[model samples]
Target: MTSISMAGTGSGLVLTASWQDTVPATLTVRAPGQGDGATPERPLVEVLTSRHGRDWAGPRYVATSVGQRLRYRSHELTSSGSWQTLSLTQTDAVTGLDVTSYLSIHDEHLAVRSWTSLYNNASEPVTLHAVSSLMFGDFGAADIDQMYLLRGRSDWLAEGRWSRERLRDAGLPDLTTPGRPFRTRGCIEASSLSSWPTAQELPTAVIGDDSTGTHWSFQIEHNGGWLWQVGEVPDGLYLALFGPTDEHHGWQLELLPGATFESVPVSLAIEGDGTLDAITGFRRASRAPGGGPGLPVVFNDYMNTVMGDPSADVLHPLIDAAADSGAEYFVIDAGWYADNGDWWDAVGEWQPSTRRFPGGIGEVLEHIRRRGMVPGLWLEPEVVGTNSPMALKLPDAAFLQRGGERVTEHGRYHLDFSSVQAVDHLNEVVDRLVNDLGVGYFKFDYNIRAGVGSDSVAASAGHGLLRHNLAYLAWIDSLRQRHPQLMLENCASGGMRQDFATVSRFDLQSTSDQEDLYAYAPIAASAPMLILPEQAANWAYPQPDMTDDAIAFTLCTAILGRLYLSGWLDKLSDDQRLMVAAAVRAHRELRDSIPHCLPFWPTGLPRWTDQWISLGLRDVGGDALYLTVWRRDTEPGQVDLTLPPAPDGMRWDYPSAVFPVESPLRIEGEPSGGTLRIVDVRGSHAARVVKLRSVPVE
Candidate 1:
């Protein structure tokens, strides 16, 4: 038998694999000083084909015939700067199929990205039903009962709602009875269907060892269908991540002789501290170069403002107020292109409305620029309204269709970016908007889900959808290349498409379409756990009718992340307007350090009905900490929060000063680790932002 181990230079993670002449290769990952170095019994790669099915009758992805027959062939290790990659090659002798699994990690990140490519070397065709992107056994040394599972659920108005449950409670039973060795057929699975990756269930999960405080977190980096499962096997607990499956998504591909197929990419992060640390590592590995663009304060005319029915007179004052309140970009949301108020179904022409903007839409965009802010427009670029002229003008092949008919949803037809006609048409629209109308930013929104997939020009409907998803990302890359200075925001009915696949590419992500300030607190606080704080655009729509405390509460929700300002700022009194300005100023002062700060939750993950929620951003140096806390309707005037160890001689202060009328904060216990007491004398429905700074003992 031969064994190989690779260690991350700075991450302190170890990957070990073992194989022999008659045994299949097995792989496992663990952090430093975690678990005994036992050889995993499960195979490194799992593949299900039409010819070879599962060896054991179960719903899990492991214990497949092809997976158990794959023997180790060769391995290679390569590195470039801080990044290192390890490729393991395995082959099934009977079927003449080869699998090359690639694992890449950064020296500074305790996360690993994994994927596999399959090549058919036989003479006949190979029908693939499912292929695992990543698989590993013996996740933690503790028993299954002592571990917990964490998952997130998201929707239109409610996004980033996370829940934690024990492994047994999450539907995975412990079948380790003495004398009788039986593996259960059930597993804990989280999956996303159709085009909206994050509409129903988020493609991220975490398994924590309650006794040891260790955590394992993972995320599927796909914009379409994805599935992840955790199940028990004879050897130990196993995890499998995949892009799509024949059973769940009807995704099957036939590989002809010498044909190759690559699986979707997935990431795994491990930490001994807690689940939040694992997530922080995962977020760091998923970031792009320079960690995205600057956090510019954006103001949109939607969500409690004009509510998508904007007119020249209505937008003129809002634009002026947004500029006066220190907004850097002003986006004219939906209905700007509608000739009438009924703009939902007649959208694809990309023309200014004559009735809504009698002076021309250009007038409002020019007004935005005159007030010293970049002009932006809201666009749903991936769909053509059924009643739109472009629906008839574009070729039938340019849109996604199944069974020879166009796929329609919510009065719109999904566009296939693989088609030249579709790309060319959107290219022209964007060029015209940028070159002719002087628009500098775009809020790209997607409002519909193209069911199953498109069967036009592909092996299956699921395959067709997967191809289009990749093409759409490539199109965005090309668009950025053409207009290098332009900023783009990704919005899918408000975060339905909030995945690393999109967040890593877009400048900002609209966290939600949630309109109520009171309910939006938890969503805003939980967003940084999934995406970078600099890229999370939380809306703070403080209206003139809201009280001073309520205005501060809404502003506090946005100050820690990308401040998205809205509401009727023009109608606000002088004091109210100043509060909004103060919030923007505070965000600007701290935005530069946001990209370098790691996120933590002092009060655990927020529940939908939780009265108190807190999110903290700690700097890399551990000297500065910015904490935002929200208190919903409750009888208690103060709440005690458990915080991480602070630097020696550190003191708490309110940095934003937006809530000067609120009570001061108090700390108890030792300076290293203590409880923070936050008092909101105004009581229920109030929020505050405080900073902890290190002071020299003079």
Candidate 2:
């Protein structure tokens, strides 16, 4: 940003810079000027094609339009401080536009900036009647839709198979999913939230010259603020939505000068670094609210080399392994019971396959408990297999209908969490595990997409999809409320729907069934790392064509993440088990440090090449610092050390091996710190952990 200025008063763009409680608040713009360009204080500029006026039930109409006209009447609720508007100016360093906008929290003061060559158009404002006309449906919304209602709709629609995009231009193409019902949640590509016109839903008009088009914007109230803006470029495009939760006024603008012009500021939320800083505001911190370390490490059994009837014999190794590694939780994964091509059907039966576990589920829990580890069980509460008991009882009409027929994505069906019966189903399953079976932790899995709704109730709600999503969340809420200390996981076919909402709901998350090998990037980039560490990545004995130590090193690296482990712990060699113990010990050591000091930036983590110097600080006041330099078996380059800030009067050393102070070490740009020389740290070399000696602070 450059050359920012402020203003206070009526009629136009408003920007304000203030100090609140000693916190420096920079310029904030709430409204903008006309025609696609930024002026001082205004954060948005707009462009429009044509506009029309229509009278609805309560308001006059003023809609900037390309194909359809949207009208909304201005309801001025208050005007006391209306004239006390604030204005400011902003010049983007990158764009170099002279941008100006406004800021106001008052009510009943707004105008519609319209751009139109609209041919002798009357100066009438547009009125919106969205509340009067509404559309309700059971099937999920089509991107091509315009209006929606929350009532007068009832029917369970099956899970949808496609998400289609509307194409208006001659050469434009419809984004199609064809016959593909969403497969695994982890695998689905995000569908477009864009369409032809979430733009002209407001008032804006400008006279368009054949040489150029008009630009404009909608001053929308969103997320408890009036300063939200939707910018429309000269090409007639803008996309932003308000949640209807703020009491404020706003307006849109358009410019139609002789030569259609384009020079203005827009309220986008990214810096040139290609960083999505806006995503930070949406992020919720990961440490569970009021949570303590109840279970440090959890081990998974049954998935690795032990998938027969899943018996005490199979668990013997797991128990001894847990005892040796001191893992505090043991989870018995799928296939422990009799599964006959039916995931949901046999699920509710909730009994151990007698053939494998002659001792029974309770007995198995006793074994884990005796070993001082909490026992965990896995369940998919949202799914009801075709052969499941519940599916046999409910009719297809009870579910959602789509295009007129019941929708079914995969063979597994989605449970209508919106129904009371569904709630009972969930509670029943929980009761079986927590109350009867004595399971302390639960892994909740939803391997299917949400389009399934055969429940009679969800059929009529205008906001069926939204409601359903809320209902699922509500059920989780209810469970949490009741079992205040439940450590449950929300796994959706391997890390899908791993958003803030889900993360906040579930105590832990099952990142993926794909536990290792390529788990790092997706979880780091797509999934939020702050929520999940202690993830499930384990060291295993090297399979054929693989070395045992390689698996051991991989497991040690994985232990650094926030995930659980899924492997046959019993099958590990003594050396591998020792490595596991060492990794766990490291995790235990770093558990209590605050986020900023001990936290890691997943994107900046060292690559597998291993010859990179990674840094971590214990505290700002402490002289002690930690850095890891390891060479991957792949790369053979010598690792260079770029020391972070450290105290001058201290000695630094590698793990158990201190490097001697070296002369002629470049210190020009280096922050004051003890210097040392590190030779080649690659080619099957052991990793070195360096700690700086303490220094006194004045």
Candidate 3:
């Protein structure tokens, strides 16, 4: 028996998934009003499992699961405002073990969040090999030529590097080839059981067809041990999302009778248009819930300026300057916890260094409070320095261990949040910092990865890491619950721990640790590809001696997102100070519209060394738009930006003083929309933020 149901997502998309006794179960999405009423034949969701007594499939670890052989049991549907959930249950014909998949959709963004659960319905215990958080059916037309896959790559300094590839060019053999059964090949994955999850790659991808404006984007929401795959199948391509699959990460689970295991969560967005639509859909769907503090301008003393060395004499002037410059939160990042100059290995104590502070850190905190800025501190909670007393005092279970030996990386031991002692220790540290010290913001930093993870008490190293990740999220939730006013920023040595799982919980995300303002341009321009603009805390660390063009360039980098000011603010000349202040004032004017606007790039994704780049945010109601353009080199520094169709005579304003243009400007109207012929009017390494207002056409 089989059943099919369709629901409109209110955003021009229709989601449909079906299950049948003879056919495999799957979920698919399509643009409504275009396709016939008949249900699409491909299922996007795939599930694979292993039973002790059954015949083996392909690989003990990576065998793909097709739902055709399973027995369809039942399903349920529930709805709330703009959101709906579809839960389906299927059982293995031979073992009676059941798998239930939950697919939740929100109409506001035409997006879906999915996860799976394994239930031991049988009388005996069952060992499971794998469960997927999400699996996607191929989108776009039958011909693969129009299909392209988008992937984001990241590193310590070079972050948010995105590239596009044609699906057929991926060289996957055609599944429709005669007598050739399709074989899945080569998967692009980003896995981090280690501390730096985004160090190598971002857990996000997009599939789009150029010929047809259809696109699909998905992101895995796990802080540790995540894997997503794109492979070719018989009818179309498929995407598989899981956390630490057994083949790569050595993960497995045992479910005793009546026991259950829930897979990690994944979110997917379906848009009827281009890459920008998909990206905007993701941002709207995965944003942090309301009740947190508003995103404000922050000043940190660690990037390119202070470099973590802070004392009373060093910080007092900076705090005064930051407060004067309109920074709302002043964060003293790193090196405040230890008196010793070499403070990396002396962490875990989290005590303010009296030697560094001299008059005590509280004096500085009081000064910041008096200056009308919130006080923030840097903390690395997941590690205990080898030299710290807690390393020796805590039980073996408190720290990550392989067999009986504790795992050490980069002069620190990874703390296992699954252990009560570890959680309690971190809780105490946070409570003390938030309560006793009157701290309102925290910049949480993670510096190292634990490699494959600890093998303490779990089925596998991957299993142990998964347990710890969940526990860590739970701890963070509890902290937020205890202190609802506290704002937490997630950083793994800067922008490495980026994912929806962490992004949804925290208030802000550090975009990068790159100190060079010139080199940081592409990173800031490309940030909206992965993070919400309001939550992307990009650093605007303009040095005192930098040229006006250079200063404007760096300030523009931070203004689009959460402005993170650093560098020597007190030493800036009057002219330089005015430029910085103008950037901040511009950001404040643009901040309110940021939460409701959708991001789009006029010239597409920025290259690492692109001479010209543009990022645009337009309101959904078509009333206004904010565009930032950066010119890196002295070459052609000109771009003709064509905005989405807007009312005629839209007002355009630019601050020529800050963003001096060397070229003449020409404005024209085209069939596509209004065109800004912004000619050679800017110095090299300069930028401008243009505000466009739409007035009713008379």
State the displacement of the C-alpha of residue 293, model 3, in Å, after optimal TM-score superposition: 4.0
Candidate 3's C-alpha runs over 4 A off are 4-9, 37-66, 138-140, 175-195, 278-282, 290-292, 647-673, 681-683
State the displacement of the C-alpha of residue 65, model 2, in Å, after optimal TM-score superposition.
Answer: 7.6
lDDT of 1 by residue, 220-335 (tens): 98899899998877766888999988888878889898999999999888865653665565666666543226788999989798888989999999999999999999999999
Query: Which regions of candidate 1 fall more than 4 Å away from where they truly are?
Result: 289-293, 647-673, 696-698
Backbone collision tally, model 1: 0
* Positional deviation of residue 285's Cα in model 2 after best superposition, in angstroms: 5.0
Indicate whether candidate 1 or candidate 3 has the larger TM-score.
1
Better of 2 and 3 by TM-score: 3
> lDDT (0-100) at residue 604 of candidate 1?
87
Query: Candidate 3 residues 313-334, lDDT tens each?
Result: 9999999989888899999999
* TM-score per model over all chains: 0.96, 0.57, 0.93
Model 3 TM = 0.93
> What ranking emerges by lDDT with the best candidate at the front?
1, 3, 2
> Which prediction has more favorable TM-score, 1 or 2?
1
Model 2 Cα RMSD, 1 decimal: 15.8
**365-451: candidate 2 lDDT, tens digit per residue:** 898898898888777776666555667666553344444454455666656566676677678778777878778777776655644
